[model samples]
Target: MGWVTGVMVYFVVWWTVLFAVLPFGVVPEEAAERESGGWRGTPRSPAIVTKALWTTVVATAVWLVIWYLVNSDWLSFRTGWLAMPA
Candidate 1:
């Protein structure tokens, strides 16, 4: 794949990884009465920076694997492994 395509793929992968990583380490806070009168459970510390770092790491790894597969001759996108039923 071209560099631009690779970057796009990586971007998509990064967001996907970020979504998957979001719920990790999240703990529901204790129920407390809010002035707004709505019960919303939020984690005490979301640790967004840490989660973002982890997402980048995971997305990079996954993107590398996908890049290798896309650029390699072993797996051809033109002629896929499974034959589509007519």
Candidate 2:
């Protein structure tokens, strides 16, 4: 993929991975805190920095795999059974 396309793909992959990683190692807020006055179901510690770092690592790996597939002949939509009629 070209530089622009690769960047766009990575951006999408990063956001998708972020949502998937957001709930990891989460701790629910205390019952007292929930009853007092606050948003319901808030995590005690969201750990945004840690999650963002992990998202970057995972997204890079995923994007690399996609880049390989698209650049290599191992998998292609324009050939074999995946080809479309002109």
Q: Give lDDT per model, in order.
A: 0.87, 0.88
Q: Which stretches of candidate 1 lie over 4 Å from their true place?
A: 36-39, 77-86
The list of candidate 2 runs beyond 4 A from truth reads: 32-37, 78-86
How many residue pairs clash per model?
Answer: 0, 0
lDDT per residue for candidate 1 within 33-81, as digits (tens), equals 5875535697767999999999999999999999988877667645556
Model 1 lDDT, full chain set: 0.87
Task: Please provide TM-scores, in order, for all candidate models, with all chains considered together.
Answer: 0.81, 0.79
TM-score of 2: 0.79
Summed over model 2, clashes come to 0
Model 1, 52: alpha-carbon shift in Å?
Answer: 0.1
